[model samples]
Target: MMTHPPRPLALGTALMLASQPLWAQETQELAPVLVQERRTVLPSPAAPLHTRTALPVSVAAEQSFTRADIEALRPRDIFDLMETSLGMNITRQGSRINNFSANRGGNVSFLIDGVYLTATQAQRVVGDIPVGAVESIQFIRDGSVLSILPVMGFGSRVSSPTQGVVVINTQPAPGKAAQDRAQIKASYATYDSWSTSGSFRHSWMDGRLQLGGGYQHAASQGKPDWNMAYASDTYMLHGGWKDPDFMAMASVFINKGEREIQRYIGVLPNSSVAVGQLNSATWKYDPRDTQVFTLNLARYWNGQHTTALTYGRGKADGTAWYYATNVNPDTVAGRYFKDESTDLNLSHSIVGEQNSFKVGAQRIGYVQLTETLASAKPAPREEEIYGLYFTDEYRLTPAWAIDASARMDKKHISKGGDKYGADGSTLKLSDDTWTDKAWLLSLGTAWQINPTWRLSGRYAYSRTPTPDSITTSANQELPDERLSRWELGLDAKLHPALQASFTPFYYVIKDAKVVDSSAPKIKVFNADTGSYEALSVYTSAAEVIRKGFELSLKGRFADDMLGYEVGWSHFKDDSVTADSGTVETPKNRYTARLDWRYGPWSSTLSALRVDEYCHYFQGACLPTGDFTTVNLNISRRFEHGIKVSLYGQNLTDKRYYTRHKTGNGQTVYNLSDGALADVGATYGIEIGMDF
Candidate 1:
């Protein structure tokens, strides 16, 4: 172990540090009265670098999820965990995966290691990724248009990706631990579900080189008779080398997951149609397999100059049940998509200066292959995207800072497939490629106001092309989406142990993709009859406007051992059509979490409440009921590096549906007889050992 002497701190730094939440500052505080007392503490087994709780204030309004938060919540999956977090809503349909939206009906995007995950098929598999390998999750509510534009312009449907960005950072290399350390955990829960996972980190050459790996397996008997059953296997490996002038890191991850789905069931038992009841019929399989590899290298020079290169490849293959008028509804089909990208970034800052600048360029390519059946001819599609961006940050004074950025992107899409005529003649689909281009600009400023208060505001504008989806055909083209947003925020330190924030925002998305269930049945030719039959399909509205405000408060007491967080969001999202109908956003939503720790025992109590909203059914708005759920968890740690935990989800045993979106992009009810069908109370216990 090595220790370094503490250096004198500046007055501004001291004031800023004092404004941070007590819970996040506890482990970093040190008092040095004399020269000998200046010795810093070395690495300890209880505190690992990869699990640090440091949260640097950002220009954008942000929320964070740390390892400590995860340990207390014991969520069943990422979606389960995020739903409990601030500013996120996930509703479960009849399948294992759920519908997700953030910031009160704003689009949400996901990224891993700064690499775009949503542009690839990997986005569909995010629900199955093992959280065992995750180090931290950050949700930037007001993303910079420069960063959001290229992603949206390329393929993402979010006209305003700036509204929400979820960045997932996996565990990094081992720290300066003297020897190898490891932990293993096993758990069982209601619904006949179980999981086992293990991870280990080791360092070599005085911590200059490090390696780590983790694996997890989980399975669950979702419902009766194996319906909606689920299972998954995931593995991750990471390696890194660091030195004074250069650093390199590499990581690889693979996931194989399977899920079962139950088709639409009517909300009423004796309604015009019967649906959603547990039946003896076998559930359809929705299998997903994903693999990703990423490498990052950086070079450092004197006087605060650095250059970095990053490259990542991600691929996903899966089978899903799609409604086909000509085939059995229970059948599954295969599809695959792949993404590759490389980026180069350069940044410079003068030593002891208050300004910084950064520039970056990137190129990405994606491929998709789809087939209705194993022997059917495949449809191949490809896209190429190129981007360039620049950002500048300047501190006008000790209490004021401002930033500006700009970005531009170009995307090209092409497809290859056979067009079959009714006379059995084959025609070549147009190989001519189409291209889209977009640019974005943003500006933001933050003022400390005083030692106990801060204020910030931002405005951004961007344009994005229509999103490409599995159902999109070669000839299906739509106009680009345009968006802009302005937000104002206030942060206040009400007390030494309490912190609060209030953010008000407004955004408009033109040509946005809003839920629309009014589309009539479409005709599809059947080979058997050489005739056409009409089948219902989902649809979407072209535009909308969203306005909202978010409030959050957190407090810590009892020497940072007891803490609580409260969050609330109110929004009004409406379509621009003549009807002026409200969009699928909750008018009011609230969340609360309380955490307490005494000696070796810790506990967490959480709750979520959502107000009633409108749902589209049969081309009409229906009242979707409001619901509330409470969850609890308790855990104890022993002296022998062993820990045990017990948790219950929906502890009140309340009956509720997570809410669902149908194939036609319309929100639908998932209840039966005015009660939940499958999502009931669930409980679990876990035991683990650290070495």
Candidate 2:
């Protein structure tokens, strides 16, 4: 089972081996062309999107969700696999749902072709990326941000943002060594809504350089005050080149993404929070253009050491703000805003005896400028952040290896506005240069205890950045948002075709930030005074801890092509109430997904459950109980890049909220248990083609 690191068969095997317990199967190396960037530049002349088992970690995991062998049928996103893997659950309070991957989405980081694609969306912005366009996705669940993997902040924990790299090959180019393919997909849902997308790609010599483009649009219908209209478009241009001497990939997206949020909460007019909903509120993140360019240069020097230099530049310009407010039913409260950022990145990796180490640096300039009418005043600031990180991986033994790394970021508010405590107020504060620094450490061990069995585990200590408001001395440096995480687990091979893993983990968010901001200059005051200790663009200086267990199962009992997988997880956040002094966790969440394939038929089944989730507004919760849901998908495959899929979600019409109740009484947490759930079911018929 020795892998050459340059074979398609080994690629899939590597993915399977890295994710779960390895099976007893012969392995082979991939074609020379396949292992090189040149392969990606060539087309298979069979499909639109590159359909292969070999892909980098950044691509989404397709077989995990689309395979039908051991699966029933379900409709879900690629991230949904984590739901079942770790008994994870997603709660949608309003229109947006936070999609977590393996590890209950805890400590998950996202990347597209090595560029970090991390942004806190005002609301759930539907990305028009076609699932079929994905080639393969690599994941390092419960790993470290330094593990060349993704890790998200623990839930409700205040931590600075971090990112890993992701690489995607939407289409293969022409005249190259790799296969080129295009993918077109169309689907219509229950609300007379339909989504259409098309993607094209081409390549150059030996797949040294690849070019790809894609576009997607989806639209639907709704009621009067509850009108629902969502039509969005995204255009992407991506290219990559890999040679013995250099490797580079660049991508840009111009998106006019829009969404019409229905006033489903208007019925609860008693809660003025609903006031914002009835206003035909439309949120459009319309990014005129977002671009990311990455270049990697590596050469084998004397075959003993590898020298590499990586550089990246990214820019994002778009509108980022909320329009209507429940506090003010009038249109005067709504206004447009702007958000823009520019960043540069560089890294170097070196090889050593039985060990490899890498170090990198990043500089980012961010600006939040409001785009208001002539009458509007400016409340904008420009800030800069400098970050440095290093990682090391060791090959202790063929059976057991170890990985460790750390990173630090120093952020400076080169410029910002002065703060006034208010008229005769002692709380007056001035803006000072703010700096944030972080560190991360991780250890991993993978032991092939025997030929038929293997075991692995990981534990990490990581510190991310928090908001400047969290640390101040009349104006002090921002505190470092910190997280202490430890994960212990085991993988076992019951047989060759069957595998299983159980991982229980714990994480603590120290000095997590609590957001409470205000602008007293204008007579407008936040009535929630006690909670309104202070106002800031971002805030959190509290401590919160989260613990959970994750389980994964997948085996091939049928033919070799048939794939089966099932996963489940349980998560809870323990806390004590301020008044009653009772210990409780947000909720007990669970998820289950099964996928199997037989012949051309592939089906999947998924389920999600959250126990007694408390929704507090102003300081209240909706109710106590288990909120559950189910989804299913069925599809068939054919030759020449053409396939159709039938999918149904929320089969039981279980209504649930994507968000938790955070406010208090007068304007907060009083409501029916599942008032925010999407109770109705949605089904869609999809047609896909690649080549």
Candidate 3:
């Protein structure tokens, strides 16, 4: 058994210092002090770097969360944090693996400081980062053109047509003074889980140059019979320099972890297995490691023009172990894989009197190799992508604006591997290559209806390449997926202390890809077992229509001491096929949060409700019951920068299970018994300090 070290008292002291100006102003005694502070805190006069294009007007729905929000929510993991956003859903398939969907079966694109990441890398890196290390998170629900820049790479595109994007920024804003500070946090929770982290930041030259680093470790011995023990360690280092004309930032992140696949406690209704018997393949990732690096640079040629460049690299290696049924130790197999990716982007922006224009180019490359117990050698797959794009925003008047964007992307893929057949026979595949190109477009407009109201609308068309599973399994190329969407939004200041927004959206997708488990089984050779196995077949649907609406209200009252946020999202999908169905996404979801503060004490309460939805599995639609959960956090802040908090999740101890998408693109439960229940009520206390 592994145990955490002893806890320490939360005690720290912070000192504040102010600098005097070299020259004093005689007009007023405070003028010089104010001027000096502004100069040090404000950004340079040059145009700042634009990682992603920003819309001139609020034509799309977007949600943003600050560090304060994160602290109040007290989320335990990335999945918990993302679930707070509207129209977003997270389902965990393994301890560190998850599926993210937005707006009714639409895939999501993920970015970190404008650096694009593949789907696999996103899951591995983002899930490992400590919540305290994140400075902010933004969710773009309707800006397809602006969000599509990251997916134009050779790396795995969104598995399905994307309806949203999630951007994470880890760098924190510089403070008012050049200072050095550190933070330490630790907590213990149910199931013998423990988490600990430490971080520090140092600034120099009037806060113009800074360096920061952190390390985090977490482990848990899950409930008995679940076999879900997990452990991970993460390290991060970042540095940046800023000046009037030039800026540069670089960061490196590394994570290593291992998790055992969970098991079920009961048998399915139609299964022949014994009653009350635990069932599932015994599987685990013995060891997995991933590393990521990014560099960002910007040159402000003038106040009106700027050039920026961003580069990123990622590497991952892992080994998986599979044991015979009943966890027999004498018989086992291993599968090993390695993946690497590189991405580069360059852009120039021009600011005119009434218009702004941006042009950019990007290149991305990826390589993967895999070896199994029975394979003779490692198989290799490689890809390269090139993209060019342009965007323009014109202001017709101070009260109205219009924006347009266009992009062209091309990708080339080469693959050589051992193809297995029905009777456990292997066929060596030659180097096969394929190339594809696509174009995307978007148009948007906004109008100020009145002093307190605004209206906006946007239309966008996007396309993505078919998934690798379908292409590789079929041993051929396939038609790309395409989608078109329209969204309308209205924002209103209903009261002096309240704001509200309403959005309605519609989407149409062509050649939607899916896996049919009930269809004729495709026989595939299992390298580890040296035997043939039946697997799900992949197919494409002609079309799918999805429509949804979102409503949200946020405000502060009681002299800013009490704040609240409430949101509701509803969506339904219809597939144009008699035997096919889309049921992974719930039709109705509701979320609410309330914050209260009085002097040094504060509390936050949040709730989520998801309506029951059918899951398409094995040609049948099974009902997945609805569930509701509540989380609460209470904290006290001391004058010396010390904070202590108590947090609890699923306070009611409700039991529920979520549907997840499998590697084969099929929707199914996490357990072989058709049920993977959530970990019931858990409580923990955490303490932290800054100096």
Model 1 residue runs over 4 Å out of place are 1-60, 94-96, 119-123, 145-162, 173-180, 262-265, 269-276, 279-283, 321-352, 416-432, 466-480, 510-544, 576-583, 660-678
Q: Best by lDDT, which number?
A: 3
For model 1, residues 582-635, the per-residue Cα lDDT tens digits are 236677889999999999999999988878876544444444537788889999
Error of 3 at 281 (Å): 3.4
For 1-691, candidate 3 gives per-residue lDDT tens digits of 1123443322311111123333533232442111111111111112232555354464547888888999899887877888878988876655336777786556676777667766655666677677887878888776465733644443334354456778787776434224678989988888998989998888888777989888989899987767778898989898798777887888888889987777544424554233355555566777878788889888888887888899989877787776546666656657786777788988898977677788899887778765356344666677766888888777777667788988877766666455443333465544556555666888888777665677888888878777454323344455787878888988876775689999999888887665543354455546564444444445566787889899999999999899999999998887622234344688889999999999999999998898987666545555564889899999999877889999998887876767523222123222234455677799999888887
Tens-digit lDDT track for model 2 on 1-691?
Answer: 2333554556665675566533432353333234522121111112111111122111111123222222244333343433443332333444332443232334344444444433432112213333444433344444353433222221122334332222333323223425676778788877777778887777778677778877877567743344445565667777777666555556665556555544334324455346334433333333333444545445544444455444444444444323343434344333344444454555555555566566666665655554443355665555666666566656666555566666555556755533423331223223447644556676655555654455555656766654432322333344556667666656666875777777677777776544333312112133212222222223344777777776777776666645556555566654323221122333455555556677888777777675665443333444533656678888888998788888887787855444433333333333321233353678889888877
- Better-scoring candidate (lDDT), 1 or 3: 3
Q: Estimate each model's TM-score.
A: 0.80, 0.72, 0.85
**Best-fitting candidate, scored by TM-score:** 3
Alpha-carbon shift of residue 406 in model 2 (angstroms): 1.8
Note the Cα lDDT for every prediction shown: 0.63, 0.48, 0.70
lDDT of 3 at 34: 17
